[model samples]
Target: MWADKSYTEVTFKGCRPTEPASNFDKSVDIQLYTAGFGDKVGPLKHFTKCFELSTSTATWTGLPKGLYYFKIVKIGGESHELKKIDVDQVRVDTTLAD
Candidate 1:
């Protein structure tokens, strides 16, 4: 997802109970990247302040918007204990500052 303007904060909720269940059972590192309004994404620019499977939520603040995407790292357990979750299990939502 892309934000049109700078945002004070952004939040990511990890799982969707409504969606089909998967073998997701571990904390993950949410890798955030940007492309400066272009299609090419830059290197690993930031990580969420907190990443946990227990809470199923991730967040980062002070983000300048253009184009962005998230990569969930260390799926399953920290050492990749559990099986990989379905691709459908991942979801992204964004709200720009008013």
Candidate 2:
């Protein structure tokens, strides 16, 4: 590998059940850790409705009320080491009724 690199992302969602929200439908957050970046730090990317960005976070809203969970993925190349983050689903309660 040429050099070690890492990334992180997070999404914030707000809903009122008035409209369906697809942006935060597949939103995710992850905590990254690797030995490759001994001293150097990487950037954290936030996504809102599949929009790739380099900001601290992505704010979303206008979604139905329901339970939701966070999804995380560890990215790596062929030459670089790969690690998958282990996380569990969570319950997100909303006022919307199905």
Best by TM-score: 1
Position 35, candidate 1: lDDT: 55
Candidate 2: residue 63 Cα off by (Å): 1.1
Root-mean-square deviation of every model: 6.9, 17.5
How does each model score on lDDT? Answer: 0.43, 0.28
Q: State the lDDT of candidate 1 residue by residue for 8-66, as single tens digits.
A: 23344443322234544433444666755334332322322223332343444556556
CA shift at 33, candidate 2, in angstroms? 23
| Cα TM-score of candidate 1 | 0.45
Candidate 2 structure quality by residue, lDDT tens digits, 8-83? 2233333111124332232333332333343222333333323232222422234222222233332221111233
Model 2 lowest lDDT segment of ten: 77-86
Candidate 1: minimum summed lDDT over ten consecutive residues — where? 42-51
TM-scores for all candidates?
0.45, 0.24
